[model samples]
Target: MKWLKFKILILIILMLQVEAKADGIYFGGGFYSLSAEVGNKSTSLSNPSAYSLSYTKSFFPQISFEIGYSFLFESLIGGDMSYGPQIGVRYYHYGTSTNSTASLEGLSIHEVKSYNPYLSAGFSQKEFQSIKSSYSGFYLGGGVEMGWKKNLSLFSDFKYSQLSGPVQGKANELTIIVGIIYHDF
Candidate 1:
């Protein structure tokens, strides 16, 4: 009876370990670059560096939701400074599996690399000559994350946004970001 109880305890511990790898919350911050176009202008104003912060929650091993904010450091054609919030969904693809679904059974917990692609939409408020205007848009982008430690990873992505309103002509913005995430396991 003692040996049987020990075996059951071991089994329960293994199951808990697998469950821990399936869900988590992560917070990250990084640098970003932005380029914006105004009116019919062929030349777009570009800022080489900006800052951003984000939070992501994983409900499954391969799926997560993210919310982020970015601060553009330089003045663009229509704005002196811009800041915004964005929300998106991320899908993780592991290894060479064409299906890209995450399976916990027999999966190694030490797996460190994955392909993550995401889609998002948000609103931005731009301040131009002391006047603030709001613009709404959607972003499409994809990125990859590489695990550095048990609960830490490094990631980068590029996104393009098409915004409407708060301007006379069509406005488009492009951004690239690189950051680190700390996951609660």
Candidate 2:
């Protein structure tokens, strides 16, 4: 009886370990570079370094939702500054495979050993330090995520945004980001 109980305990522990690889909530932090162009000029108005923090929920195999905040401040004297909230959707292309549909019932951590790419689109509201006013915008971006360890992943993203209120002609913004995310296990 003692040996049988020990075997059952070991089996339960194995099951719990298997459950740890499932995808769910994620928290991420990253740094980005921002540049803006006015009118049809190829020259950039300002190039600033910024940072962001985000929360993400992977609801299904192909869909995930994210909300993030980014801040850009050049100096304490307020040379140029911008801060905003980004809400976006990520669509994952799992590709075609014989077992793809069955495996996607829940994506396992091992599935990300290869580079997983996704496209994202969202809305943002930014507060500009120069004008002391808020502006809303729309952005489109794409990124790739690479699995690192048990519950950590690295990602790189590039985004382009068009703001409603233009500083000079029409402000077109571009941003590139690199970050790490921790997944719920």
lDDT of each: 0.55, 0.62
Q: Residue 185 in model 2: shift from native, Å? A: 6.5
Model 1 misses residue 82 by how many Å? 0.7
Residue 68 alpha-carbon offset, candidate 1, angstroms: 1.1
Q: Which candidate leads in TM-score? A: 2
TM-score of 1: 0.64
lDDT of 1 at 72: 68
Tens-place lDDT digits, model 1, residues 77-181? 234667777787667654211111123344333434454444444444333233356666677776766556666666676667776645564456777777776
Q: Give candidate 2's error at residue 4 in angstroms.
A: 17
Q: Candidate 2 lDDT, tens digit per residue, 73-96? A: 564224677888999888878521
lDDT comparing candidate 2 with the true structure: 0.62
Q: Return the TM-score for candidate 2, rounded to 2 decimals.
A: 0.66
Q: Model 2, residue 61: what's the lDDT?
A: 58
Model 2 poorest 10 in a row by lDDT:
96-105
